[model samples]
Target: MLFVSTMFESHYIGRFAPSPSGELHFGSLIAALGSYLQARARRGIWRVRIEDIDPPREVPGAANAILRQLEHYGLHWDGDVLWQSQRHEAYREALAWLHEHNLSYYCTCTRARIQSVGGIYDGHCRRLHQHADNAAVRLRQQHPVVSFYDNLRGEIHADERLAREDFIIHRRDGLFAYNLAVVVDDHFQGITEIVRGADLIEPTVRQISLYQQFGWQTPDYVHLPLARNAQGDKLSKQNHAPALPEGDPRPVIIEALRFLHQPDIGAWQDLSVAELLRRAIDNWSLEHVAENPSFSNALR
Candidate 1:
């Protein structure tokens, strides 16, 4: 289904939802600066959301350190931070809505079973109506999104087979999956614009479908290119990307701004944190940003 809604009024609400898997790295900074600058460029409200729903994957004290690093780098977010872990009730409500409307089902398929078949999940349990207590909550693909238009990247499409697959909403272990949580959270916050990493482009289709299922408005999406490592792997916690330095954060912040295509405040290497951000905010521009990935090892 390809239903297009009018733009999200560029009243511009942008956000950076970082997982507390480890400390913020170069990739994290790129996404942060990109979203922040884009929001500032439109005179929008930039918010911070901590995606910490999976307790086992979260590193102790990592969330606090992330907030500290953002502060040190002068990425001031509006409003209090929203934590996914604290919003289980909201997730529960979403799940219940799906269940009542026959939009969701319980699946007992194990990872091995799905892998043996293929990475794509076949709707093995869609007709069973299995009890929710002993299975994972899966979103039935009632209206799969085959294509959609991205603000930065034109007309995007997903693999038809994968797009039609029934993806999990709540894991068998009982935690809300990322797709479900992110979609619900965005709606809860009344997010108007989503400016984040380009890697998320593929997932936007499914998330948009969920929005349609729930009769909620889909926000405008702008996916910025990723930060790559020396080997060209995406800079991520899984790749052992180094954490941001706790010392003076100006140079790194400047690099992030430049990477985002925002104007450079010359020789900001010696400027105070406040002054650096002042120049950055004054000169922010999404048009200057590169549409391709920026490789770096500074934030390793």
Candidate 2:
């Protein structure tokens, strides 16, 4: 379950962590290709992580299918893929440490209750001193990060109220929260930079806060523009975005390159997938990427 390699010893490490809720789609391809190029350009290790922590949302065989799609598009990874399902003990240990150090407390507040209080938790349980049965665990917000430096954007500030909230680390249903798992795994994998979609930009501060709590260094981040359909909805499984088709992936790769504003060396029609990828990696530039999400008719 643990992957150890000289790849971790590299100066830079980038990863594409996807939840296997559905088949790999165009939006995800854009993200994967962007991250892959960023890593390959710097001679850094690119890794893939299957975020299978949420079982209810996952399709049965989607993880293997995703790996196949990545390979089909020539987005080769550096090591064995990491599955969050195989890392429960690590989360348990982390939770234990937080609880023992009084850095986390239990909460029994339901969704409706939080919604009634303007949708932001007011640290109601932090004062009650009650560790109720089957309660969710929340980290105490001592050092809330209101802003973080993005590799592309100079300084992005987060909503002060949201940043100050004592966010959940584990759910009442016994599932580890995304922010906690991502921070822990990013550190575990020795990630130096995170290149993901712009939709996740809001959570960057929360993850950075976790790094501060753990006394660990935070990685650099670059959030790429989100691909949206005609109606302005982001291309995602919940919105029913179509999966990457089974065929020659050159054209789609070229489209993704254009989406990121990367230069095309030669005519893509005359190039193979491997060759196109080589050119893309050779010409990758983070400075060319857009700062905000975009609505594209091609994604429609």
Candidate 3:
């Protein structure tokens, strides 16, 4: 139960959190650009967070590469970059609070059993009083949120079974689960809005449920349309999507602007990256962005 008295919910505070799985690609650029413009358009604060918790998936020097890529595209963020790896103490303290309050329990449910039960976890272990030895921890879903509102798409809902399940907060492999860490970090960072890709929309309700459990404010969410390739697969590092070019960000920036359905101003070719960013920020509008997934030759 990590609670905060101060509310940043009144003002605009946005963040772009990227995992160090690999360098920034075209799809990731859309997220960064959209979040940056959304914050700057209101003269609000924009922050960056390095989500490097999953060491198995992280690449060497990928974090630095991401920062460099952002700089190359003139997507400057405000304040210090918060690293998830350094926040283990905070996560520990939160888990401790939940345990003390009887709001969480340990479970040793296997993946095969979960799949046998149709993949959504049941509360079978909630009343079993399972031991903590080599077990994962799950939060007691006191108030499951089935639906939430999106800034881009309205009135979003989650699967009923998923919303009602006792979701994991700590993994059996001795790492904090993403749902728990993300909610805790967002609260710690005082984020008032979350702007990311549409692929993440399904987790919004789970995150909101966690916020409710913590008695903290839930931030606004804006899930930008995903970028797809010619074959219709969403551009992703897993798909070995090509990384953004290091030289000359001008063309890609213009293409990204076009992908978002923003006005090009007919002089993007003559403007420097910084000036183009300035113009784009001034003209950025969430309403103007496309609702469908964007497909283009833009470096993803």
Whole-model Cα lDDT of every candidate shown, in order? 0.83, 0.87, 0.87
RMSD per model, one decimal: 4.7, 3.8, 3.5
Q: Could you give candidate 2's per-residue lDDT for residues 39-105 as a string of tens digits?
A: 9999989999999999999999999999999999999998899999998888887788778779999
Instruction: Write the candidate numbers in order of decreasing lDDT.
Output: 3, 2, 1
Error in Å for residue 263 of model 2: 0.8
lDDT: worst 10-residue window of model 1: 291-300
Question: TM-scores for all candidates?
Answer: 0.91, 0.94, 0.95
Local error of candidate 3 at residue 138 (angstroms)? 0.6
> How would you order the candidates by TM-score, starting with the best?
3, 2, 1
Candidate 3 has its poorest 10 consecutive residues by lDDT at 291-300
Evaluation by TM-score, superior candidate among 1 and 2: 2
Model 3 TM-score relative to the real fold: 0.95
